[model samples]
Target: MTLEQNPALAPVSDLPGPQAWRDIGVVCPFDMALDHELWRWMPDGVNLIFTRTPYYDQPVGLDMAEEISDHGEIQDAVRSVMAISPAVVAYACTSGSFVHGVQGARNLSKAMVSAGAPAAVTTSEGLLMALDALGVTRVAVATPYLAELTDRLTSFLEQGGKSVVSHEGLGLDRDIWKVPYATTCELIRQADRPDAEVIFVSCTNLPTYDLIARMEQELGKPVITANQVTAWGALRLMGREAVGPHQALLQATKG
Candidate 1:
């Protein structure tokens, strides 16, 4: 029988309700494995749900291209998350966000809103907002993508009005999550240029939560990662303060 025919499939509403709680949904890429990093930053009383867009493997360009082409799949995922009645829905793929450029990111968010989400944001769009909030225009970038895809990101950023002082990539075609924190750290160091006002580490699947604050401290500048900005944007959509010690973006949200 279909879920509609099964009474047991109904959403649980009889359970004890918290005094207050919020639900946030993440529409992720198919190969995503770093969702736990988003969860790690979630405040108490917020529930995080995930649904995947079509993607398989990577070098960024291929996987992200597939995701961008799967507009139907992405809309369906957003609608599915809406079924849970989340306060905001996030398209949580960085490459997918900027792949089509700024207008594309805006279009993606519009589609999510059309899908019934009360509000929505994509990672690339989020990055732009986060950068504005931080008052930064010059940035250094590190990525777990090939040179071509990295070039796409730099162009996207430049189009967004940010100056990319330096950019570097690991040139990996797959297994991006396997990249260690130490490697990412070194990439940031190597990507750093004297004039860069901030450092941006791209890719939602790359693990980065453990060291964002430490990186910022060591670099003496903001070290923004994909997951952190994604989470921060969703929180902003929720009309809630994103409070997390040591995370510069989150800390910046405090009044």
Candidate 2:
């Protein structure tokens, strides 16, 4: 059945106008964590800036909350990047955004727009939206975050109606920029679950465009990561194609 037959598919008409190549500033933790997967998942010609954090890695254990506090000054720091002409700004922290929950992401987005950029923030909350939009209720999660960070992510997902049947975290202390691509892919593979309808790799810093398709094929489910969902959210807000991976979930959903 066409979208014409299903009212739920009404996105084509009400979709915002004039979708085009535009820059989206990322208010990120640790500047160097902004990897190539972001640009690769983007449709084309999207511009970005990675505002680095001094800690440069996922906070270990109890320091996670302190790390979130550390990023509190990000709005002002990222404003400098957003000031350059990017149409949207995403505060790309899965944990920090989740610590605020859905309402928090909305408030953060409102703050960005109010700041003269007319922006949107993609946090762990946005990932909830992405999963909901994809029609998933059961998810498998993989991340570079330690257990505490992953637990926060777990709380956000469970509260949002997505159930995690299988979850794993690398518990790494190294900066994401130094995370080898092979290890990233392996973590996804190890984390893949048989009963999951959706797979979420929760770190924008971890490169994943190349793994989404492969992992999905192996697990037979939709695969998404922090960067992919954030970029897709930003694109849709700006009226762009939420396109597919070579083995992409968005691509697979297209008619």
lDDT of each: 0.86, 0.70
Error of 1 at 131 (Å): 0.5
Model 2: ten consecutive residues of lowest lDDT: 53-62
TM-score, per-candidate, Cα-based: 0.90, 0.79
Highest lDDT against the true fold, candidate: 1
Model 1 lowest lDDT segment of ten: 62-71
Q: What would the TM-score be for candidate 1 when compared with the true structure?
A: 0.90
Per-residue lDDT of model 1, residues 1-255, tens digit only: 875698666567854444676999899987888888889878778889999876565455745554553667889999888888999999998888888888888988998999899999999898999999999999999998988779888988999999999999999877889998899999999999889999999998899998888888998888998888899899888977665669888777676
Best by TM-score: 1
Please provide, for model 2 over 1-255, each residue's C-alpha lDDT reduced to its tens digit, 9 standing for 90 to 100: 896787676776786655555787877665435656667657666666655444535444436534643433666655677657788777776665776555665666666666556767665656876777888899888888778777877777887877888889899745665677789878877877778888798877677777778777876778888887887777766677555546565674444
